[model samples]
Every structure is written in structure tokens, then in C-alpha cells.
Target: MEKGIESIFKPYLEPKEVYKGGKNIPASTKKIYKLSSNENPLGQSPKATEALIKAAQNIALYPDQTDIRLREALVLDFDHKLAADQFITGNSGSEIIDMILRAFINEGDEVIFSNPCFLPYSVFSRWYGAKQIDVRLKDFDYSLDVEGILNAITERTKIIFLTGPNNPTGTYIPKAVLEDFLARIPKNILVVYDEVYRQFADAEDYVTALPYVMQGYNIVGLNSFSKTYGLAGQRIGYCYTTAKIANYIRQIHKPFLLPITSIEAAIGALNDKEFIANTVKTVQDGKIFLADAFASLGIKYWPTQANFFIIDPPLPEMEFTDFLMAQGVMVRPVSQFGAPGKVRISIGDQEANEALVQALVKIKTR
Candidate 1:
């Protein structure tokens, strides 16, 4: 048997369970509200359809090996001096994360980030044979522990993953605190800011780290068209960084991995300003609506800036999730993301929110 296969690999293996999260549903289900995955329930942009239709005949030919169209769109969107050599498109956000870790880490190097961060961030670090140093969050809200992350670093520390409008928790690190944190860290260490929900940040405090990239900071930003653009099923994501790091990432990644359709959709999504604006408005409104509902029910929840928010469960997270599911509401159980007692709910459209509210009310009454 291969040395890295079978039992030696078995211990670290994870069974990815696919649950019904609003993306797939039965036609006969009543109301059929889906609040899982933190995706845009508002539907995709018309521009995407137009592009896909235009590109349909081109699939027989290989997708642009370099993914030029999407890269151009991203560079234009960022409106910085990013050269064409500075971006790499991938199968999904997950693939980009994998490629980056593979590009940097060797055996026994250290990767420091936050506890209760993105579920797969730690997974990838461990997969790449790096020691994972987790800085615990300040509170149940899961804010970044900048000082702890700094203190955790040593000569062996190679990478740090920072998530803004952080998943499940939805808290953001302000620019000043980030500046301080960045200033303290050695410039050679790589900082990955997962700004997957950057579009949804309405507050001025929610600044993205892209400016760091333009300034040639040792920082990389990962983004997915899945959440804001409703393209999760299409599996398109990209990383933006300084040309040097991006070239390294490109060399480590599988070439021609992205399909033409996904790239086409991503390009259209970039140009769809109305779609971004509307998605942000809906998610922001949905967050407020859910927060108010939680307050009315006297349920404590972490205030958030992302599309999803975390609420401490009145019962085990799984049990509350099941009860909500039975009541025709679907949400993410945060156990996989390192919070066992909190459930993360994606703010859905008006009807779905009303259903979730009614379910919570009934559950509270009982």
C-alpha cells in the first residue's frame, strides 16, 4: 500500500456530509424555505445568463488556460495597478485555499489563525502537514484575536488565515486594529484575508485588506462568486495578490482546472453592479430582521455584519437544528465550524425569514 494512503491517512479523513440547505429542495415541500449556505436567495444576475448563453458553444474548446476574462474583470473591479500576472482562478474557494497552503507549507511549519474560524482553513493547514495554532476568539462573537495571533507566531510560523465578516460569526476586524496587527507581523509571513462576504459589509469599519495587496503587503484575499452572486453550484472562485505570490500560487495549482462556464458566470457577475447592490441590501435587511426577531424571542445572538449570524442554542445545536428542520426551516449547525452550542442561520428572503421566526416562536412557546 502507498505510505500516505489507507490507515495512515484514515485518522485525518473527514466525511463531508451534504445536508439539504435551501439549494436543493423537493417541489412538494410546503413553503420550502431554505436558509442554509448563506447564499444569495435573490437569484443570479441576468448578465450571467446572457454570458452563459453566449459562451455555451465555446465549452468544446478549453477554457482560457489563464482565465483572462475573469482576471480582467476582477482587476477592473479592484481598480488598482494589479498586473495581469497577479490572479489565479480556481474550481472553488476551497480549491484556492488548498493550492495556497500547498504552495507555502512544508512539514512541521506553523499556521496560526483564529479558533471558530472557517471550518476548512484549519483542515487545509493540517492536510499540508503544518501545526495549527488557534487563537481563541474574544467572546462568543468570534472576533479576531490580533495580539494572540501575533504572540502565537514563531520562526516556524509560515501562514495566517484571517476572515473578515467572518463566517458563522459575521464579526469584522477594523482597519486600525488590522494595521496594528499587520505592522507587528514579520513581512515574510503570508496573511490570507478571506473576504468572501466583503460585499455584504455595510459599515465603514468593515474595510477589506485589498489595499494591503495594492501596497505590496504580504497579504492575499480570497473571494467566491458563490455568496453574493448566487454561483455556488457553478464553482468559480479566485485569489488576488501581489504578482510574485500569485505566480507562486499559480505554479502550485492544477492548470485548466476551471471550466469555461464558471469563468463566464464570474465575469458577468463582476459586471453586474445592480446584482451586488441588491444582494447586499437584501442580506443587510435580512440580518436586521433576524436580529429583531431574536430579540423579540429573548434569544441571545452575536450581532453580525455578514449574511449569517450565530445564536446560542437553547438546546444542543443539533437538536435545535433538527427542530427547525422539522418546522420547515433549514440552517447551518456551527459544530463543524468549532462552535457546538451555536447555530448559524443564513438570512433568507422575506417569506423564509417569516417562517423561521414562526418556528422559533413555536419552539419557544413549547
Candidate 2:
């Protein structure tokens, strides 16, 4: 115990609350319906699972650190029209976020994002000793206030992080609105657009920043195989930008690139068109069903463009969550996201969705 050593780490000492997901109740023998974390209800892509199994036999060998095969598959199969060099892979979307901050942000620089958007944005910004400017969500709908974000920018602002189909709320910025916002922003400031839930969106007006990236805008598009391909456990995600920016991120990647099995699984997941299609369909259908159930129960819920939605139950968020847990269902209480008294429920399979609806109904009667 060196007494002086504590002083060195004092600047990094700050209270941080761990992000909570759906709680798992082990004591219950009943079939549990985990609608907590927004995971693929249909499970991982069959092709991805098979690929991982095959790749396991060769785990002793090192994977291509550059992730050439996975990047190529993304371009060819996803019709991105970008060269493989324009993409960079990460252990997870969270890692890419961290790398972006590490590579571009400096101490005392300002980072702007919505207050309730993503927990990691604040967590990482603080870790880097950057100033965080959080713009509050507009009204009860929890929509992003584009004007607030635009006005919050200062000369020292290094990055602006926007999550499409935003976490916790499942709300998104319209394509036209985002285009207008970007046009007004100075090109010197980098914009990080996290489109992790883009595949689940069915709105005609929804769009990706890939087109903006193609036009030489100072933007980076972050995506993950976690949701669409059910590869959360695999921890694979990627980012797309100009080749130059991609190169900077890759440099920081160094010895931290994704493992061999994750690369193979991502490649297989990208190639499996059927699995992707079915996953989208399931999420869309489940959303509709859940919306109907909410209406029937007279519960207030926000319209979601992603795989989950926030609802204000008759009970407090934590109490409601506990009730669901006791009934063998799990959901997320988002007080940490700055919207207290609301819970976010991920769309599960039909049976799981029904279980949640039935639980709510029983709670109402009691």
C-alpha cells in the first residue's frame, strides 16, 4: 500500500452505476421469458452457429487481424458499395465507441449527445477526461431534440454521438431532419452515428448515414452483428467511414482485433440472407402484437423504430419490473436513462410476448 500512489489515480475516480439488463430469476421453475436485453427472439443465425462450430477446430491459428474476409462479405452481401478498406471490425460496438473516443478525443475537449441516449457515451467521455454536454430529451415522448444538440456545440467539441433507433427509448431522428442537422454542423466536428438497430426499422423516412459518408461528410456509421444476427455473445461489430478515418481506427485496433471465430461467425451471418430476413420479420410482427396488447390494456407506450419500446405502467418501473420477474418475465427499468417510471421491453417470440401481456393483465386485475 503506497500512500502516494492513490494521488495518481484520483483524477479517474468517479462514481459510476452499472447498466442493468433483464434480471434472471433462478429460483423459479416456471419457463422464463427473458424480454430484458433486446436480443434476437429467433436466436442466432443458423449459418453463423455452424460457421462458429467449424471455426472452433482451427482456433489454434490466429485470425486475419485486418478482418479482410468479414469486411469483403459486408460490402458484397450488404450492397454497401464501399471497399473493404473503408470498414473496421471491433470486439463489440462498445469497443468501437471507445476506440473512436481514444483516437479522436483529447482531454478537456467537449462531447455532445442526448442525455438519455446511451450510457457508454457518458461513461467513456468521462473516462477520457472530456466535458460531456447532455441535451435533455424533448417532452414525454423522449424524442431527440435536434436543435438542442446543434446549439450545444462549441469550438472545443470534438465529437457528436447520435444513436438511430436510440437505446432505452427506441426513438430515432428522421432522415430528412438528420440531413438538415448535418448540413448546418461545421465539417470540422466529427459525427458518430450508431445504427445498431437499423435493420429493425421499417419507417419509409428512415435512412442510414452511409450515403452521407459516401458524400465525404465527417460521419462514421457504427453497426453490430449482435442484434440482427443474434451474435451478442460473439461480440462482433464494425464501423464504416472514409478509408482515412478507418485507417486511424485500425491503427488503434492493433493487438485488440476480433478473434478468429467471431470473424468467421460475422462472415457467415452476413451471407445468410434468409436468417436476416426472418429476424426482421419477427421483430416487426412482435412490435405490432405488443402494441396491440398495450392498447388493449390501456397502457401508454412509445412507438419504437427498433426491437424494444418504453412503456409507462400503472405501477412504478421497478415495482412493475419485479412483478414481471416473479412471473418468469424480465424487462429493463430505464431510470438511469433519465426517464424514470418507465420500463423498456424487448420484443421476444410470440410466446414470450404473450407471457408479458398476460402478466400485465394479471397485475392490473390485482
Candidate 3:
């Protein structure tokens, strides 16, 4: 390796063992159930699958440079408060995050977020040379500390990353709290609302950050078809912001950011309201079943509004996660996301949920 190579690129954040599959998996294990990533347990919409296949026939051509169709579908199907021109499409939510950072973050600028946030917030901030300000979650409920964030603000602060139904923890900011927080924030600083799992959130008090954008606030709402529509492999996501910010991101973004098939699949998935409903229902039911099993087993877990929840296993985090994996179930040990001694479990299908409970029972007995 060259001696100066380290200085040229940022270090990569290595994923955990569950993401690095096939290394420790037993040879005799059959039908491994993957519930690590918060994916739709039910498969993709049939309409989306068909669109993907049909779009593949013209794979030789470039996708629409502006991605007008997908943006229009997003507005017409999900959010109509903002026009299509206000949206910026990307390969994934990760890419949109990168775009936002690139467009707004300059070297030495400050970025604020809670600890145990979506891991990429820090990674991207470091890559762009932004000073990170991590506010610890409240001790009791692990919710974001709004007052702490307000106090952390400085003249150099550029962006604040807020995740509703935050990854790993699945804790969300309530509507009133969020409204009050936004009202107090300095308008010069941008707020990024990461809502990839918004479709699965069932809490009555949960609210989308889209209306703030329509109200001409300095906020960007990020969403993805990956979790909601089973399009993770397709790598498509979008963000809604002010037209001015959208233009700034677009000016620096390369054209054809998404593939033709991915765009078509999102459009088709949006049309299939029935599939979305069933996916939401399946996750909700599995959440109840898993929560009940955990309670009966005397295991403690965080109440979640999203498709996944964090649980404190009887053993160490990795030990429990490894045991579950050996039993053909994959759950995420979220020490990397700052919740040590806890494991995050995504809601799975009926069979997978039952299998997980059975494995947990075995652990309890052992």
C-alpha cells in the first residue's frame, strides 16, 4: 500500500457480521431468515416487478436525465404539497444524504445530530470535513434532546440531521416537539428530515416533515422506496426541499443519477396502494407478535413506531446476535449505532417471526 494513500481518502465504515454474511454461517443450516435490514418482509409489488422487467428491454438507453417522471409520480402519489421541480432524485437515500452534504457542507462547518443516529450522518460529515456535534439522547426514553441540540448551535453550524423513527432505535420525534424545535432553529441552518421508514410508522402522533418544506422552511425531507416498496436492490430515493436548494444540488449532481428500471419500478410501486397497505399490516402484526413474545420471555425492548425495535438480550449484544445467527436467524447487534448491549430486530414474515421466537426460547433455556 502507498504511504500517502491514507491521506487521500476517508476510512470506510465496515458493516457488522450480519451484513458480512456467509462467513460464520453453518454448512448444515437451511432456509436462513434475514431480518437484519428493515426491509419489507412481503416481497415487492407485482406491479413494480412487472415495470422493472418491462423497463429492462431498453437497458441500452440512458435514463431520463432530469428524472421528471419519478418526481411527478412522487408528488401525485405520495406528497402533493410540493411541485415536481422541488424534488431531487438519487440512487438511494444515502446518495441524497451525500448530495445534501456536498451542496451545503463546507470544510470546518458544523453538523449536529443525536448520538446513535443513522451511521452515515457522521461518515458523510467527516468525508466533507464538517465538525460534528453529537448530542446524547435523553437517558430515560432514549429520545432526542431538543434542548441540547438548541444549545449546541453555533455560527458555523450548517446542517442538522433529524431521523423520524430513527434507525436502530426506532424512536421518533413527536409532532408538537418537532414543530417547536423547528420554530426555534436558526433559519440559516438547514434541517434534514430522514424519513425512509415513514410508511411503516403507525404512531398516531408521528408526523411527516413535508409540510415544513411547503411552508418555505429550510428543511429537506428524505424518503426511499427501498423499505416501503421492497426496492432496496434498485437503489432509488428522493428528497423534497426548496426549489433553490434543489437547484443547488442539481447543479453539482451528474445527470442520469438513477437507472431507467429503478425509476419505473418506483412509479409502479406508488400505484399499487394495496401492496403498501399489506406490507404495513404485516409489519404491524409481526411487531405485536414479537413484542408479546419478548414480554412473556421477560426480555426488555424499546417500543417502536417503525418496522424494527431495539431489544436488550440476556447475554452480551454480539453473543446474542451470534447465537441467533447460528440458529438461522439474522438480527443486527447495534453497538455500532451507539446502543450497546442491544440488538435491533426487523419485523419479518410470519414464519420468520415464529422462528425468531423459537430461537429466543432456546437461548433462555440454555
Q: How accurate is candidate 2 locally (lDDT)?
A: 0.87
The alpha-carbon deviation from the true structure for residue 291 of candidate 2, after best TM-score superposition, in angstroms, is: 0.4
Cα lDDT tens digits, model 1, 1-366, are 566556566443455422232346546646667777887879787888688888888888987776777788887887846776788888888878888898999878999878676877887777767888988788745778777888898999999999888887888888888888888899789999999898888778677877888888899889888899889888888888988999888876665777888888888888999988888888888888999999989988988878888888676887898898888888877766767778888888888899999999988999
- 91-182, model 2: which lDDT tens digit per residue? 88988898999998888999998866778888888888899899888867777788898889989999999888898888888888899998
- Alpha-carbon TM-score of each model against the true structure: 0.92, 0.96, 0.93
Candidate 1 vs 2: which has more TM-score: 2
Q: Write the number of the candidate with greater TM-score, choosing between 2 and 3.
A: 2
Model 1 lDDT-worst window of ten:
12-21
**lDDT tens digits by residue: candidate 3, 1-366:** 667855756443233222221133246638788888887899799999999999999999998887889989988975487788889889899889998998989888999988776788887777777888999788568898999999999999999999998988889989999999999999899999999889878888898878888788898899988888999889888998889888878887787878999999999999999999999999999999999999999999989888988888888988898899888898888777777778889899899999999999999998
Q: Which 10-residue span in candidate 2 carries the lowest summed lDDT?
A: 16-25
Which candidate wins on TM-score?
2
The residue pairs found clashing in candidate 3 are none
lDDT of 2 at 103: 92
Candidate-wise lDDT, in order: 0.82, 0.87, 0.87
How many clashes in each structure? Answer: 0, 0, 0
The model with the greater lDDT, 1 or 2, is: 2
Q: Cα RMSD (Å) between model 3 and the true structure?
A: 3.2
